[model samples]
Target: MDKALNKTQDRDLIKGFMKGNDRCFEVLLSKYKTKVFTTIYLIVKDRSIAEDLFQEVMIKVVRMIRSGKYNEEGKFLPWVVRIARNLAIDHFRKVQRNPIQHESEDYDIFNTIPRSEGSAEDKIISEENTRYIKELIQQLPDKQREVLIMRSYADLSFKEIASLTDVSINTALGRMRYALLNLKKLAQEKSVPQSYENKVQR
Candidate 1:
């Protein structure tokens, strides 16, 4: 069965990775790095923070694997995700205490999308819709919002999300499901049209 084969392959990859098979490790990185980074990005909503956290996650993963601390009994992706989530949480906590916001405001991912000149009505509609959705996302419970942004914007898989957020896959799924439900609720309350929903779902 595909499930059994996947398990076997994971085990082999872990073993190979532990043995300093750099290529095998690269394979693992290639498979999960973008998903992990995107998940982190969604949480922090800052490109620099996301990039730093992503690198930290990989470094921690490499260390754990090299130190033989990585257990193979469970899925690999989830474990790495947990690491990423923990790191992000720690980073945020540190920021809250020190309150030293990153200096590069212009580089924040959640701010300002590049756009070209368009008809006045089109621009107004687009900007209003964007503002509404952004507000809606900000209102979601932290967990649901985190999952939705990561999956919807950053394109992380549920498995990767679970790993990064330190939740079970089912929990990740639940958060995403509730996030969408709440998003729908917000859109309806704002009288967002079906056309907007269609675009968002894409």
Candidate 2:
């Protein structure tokens, strides 16, 4: 995607919306709904919960723009995804109290923090070919999983990941590197299909 063009379009849409052109808001939402919805679904993992959270995200986006709280110029998608991520995190804090629910008896990949739960039954990331891969992703260490998801699934840049994760840019890059390496090792150990393994960056 042409970043300059996207930014200009977003700016125009935002300005139009601010000037009471409601269709501009609709167009903006249409442009980004897939990304915003995917970000929420990847985090929440449950279709029903994801949908509910997605509505909350859209509502928040509208409110923020209307209230003049959205000041991130030329970064419309990342700004919106940040709101989605925060709302998903809030949901996790409320409902994800099962940090050790699925720990392997031999080894636990997750640290002490609460972990997000997902299953093969999910509507979005639960394809027959991708279910195991998603499960492996859930098994990744928390920080690495976060970087991988934000980079690969959320399509965030290293700088955005760093800012959102409260780390340095190099630290964000390092986490993504380690996340890929770990996924490779985990794929090999699990004998995951090469097709699915190839989906994650090598």
Candidate 3:
């Protein structure tokens, strides 16, 4: 019920913002700023750069909305997420930077995982497993990793992902399939427990 209410409220805010209500835009930013920044940070893995890109993303989103080019049929968060992802990817392409490395020491990857209801031992074990899986994800080919990250972290549908990547739906699906297969293969090679393997798929 709260989720539904929040969605409705977000839509109303967008409507108001489109009609030139500046306060509505502020509310919208307050609601999604953390989520948007986090999504970009996950992909880019740099705090300062992510912050700069986040501002650029918001500027672009506002421009699109004001220009009446933003697609209202889609949910706003996913739309913004797609924009941020595209901008980050474009930055990387322009700079020809090396792909994101899984720097476990540099950042606490475990913080990204949700804390499940369990004992301390179970939670620790889960975090360890999640970290291991994320490391494996980072090892995937760029396309596969991007698809998996969008699907898993951004909560985007395969169709949306296809559109974002400028690929056909089948290609997006294939990348996700390959990503899972590669993860599973890595898990086996690493001797990860079967239960953790199932969790990775989930």
Candidate 4:
């Protein structure tokens, strides 16, 4: 039980994995997989898509470790998050439509974060609000939407996002600024205040 609650010593395990200790890789996954899943799910908001992206992220990490290309100097979580974020961005680009928009036959994540017990009218109103925000997000331009996701959901800093997206920090900031402006406009049109208002970078 302690192993479940305690933070995994990733450095030693990773170094061991580099030395061909395959069990260390398994240990690393057991320690971090839940956190990785949560992070990806929060961004993608679709269980199947998040699971697919999670596998892709893990495969890339494992391959990098095996290939001796893994850099140990950086924090593992951020590095993994960056990898996941980039893959998510690429997935978005190639698909050109939100995965949730399609009626999927697979499992649903919305059921997991269940609505609070409430009157039917309250539930209806909550769902409508959520759908409205999702529509607002969809209305954003590609770069703005990507930046907003990377910053808000992935929790990446401007510098990290710039590095990942091959843009200057100011450009990333600018994209974020424009994203807020667009989001606020959409919110106003929908007669709602933006939830991410304060988090938006100037």
Cα RMSD, model 1 = 7.0
Segments of candidate 2 deviating more than 4 angstroms? 1-8, 72-74, 96-127, 197-202
Instruction: Judging by TM-score against the true structure, name the best candidate.
Output: 2
For each of the candidates, give the backbone clash count: 3, 0, 0, 0
**Between the candidate structures 1 and 3, which one is better when assessed by lDDT?**
3
Assess each prediction's global lDDT (C-alpha) against the native.
0.76, 0.75, 0.80, 0.76
TM-score per candidate? 0.66, 0.73, 0.71, 0.65
**Cα RMSD to native, each candidate?**
7.0, 8.9, 4.2, 5.5
Q: Which of the predicted structures, 2 or 4, would earn the higher TM-score when compared with the native?
A: 2
Q: Which stretches of candidate 3 lie over 4 Å from their true place?
A: 1-9, 19-38, 46-48, 66-69, 97-106, 109-117, 191-202
Model 1: which residue pairs collide?
Answer: 81-163, 81-164, 82-163
Shift of residue 78 alpha carbon in model 4, Å: 3.7
What's the residue-level lDDT of 104 in candidate 3?
49
Q: Give the TM-score (vs. native) of candidate 4.
A: 0.65
lDDT of 3 at 141: 86
- Candidate 2, residues 49-119, lDDT tens digits: the string is 77799899989989889888878554888888888888988888877675424323554222221334675
**Model 3 per-residue lDDT tens digits across residues 1-202:** 2354345576787888889887788877878887787678767766667778999999999999989988878898899998998899797896676655434466654555469999998887777776677567767888998888788777789999999889999999999999989987878778785558677768
Tens-place lDDT digits, model 4, residues 65-102: 88977788876766888888778779877778643365
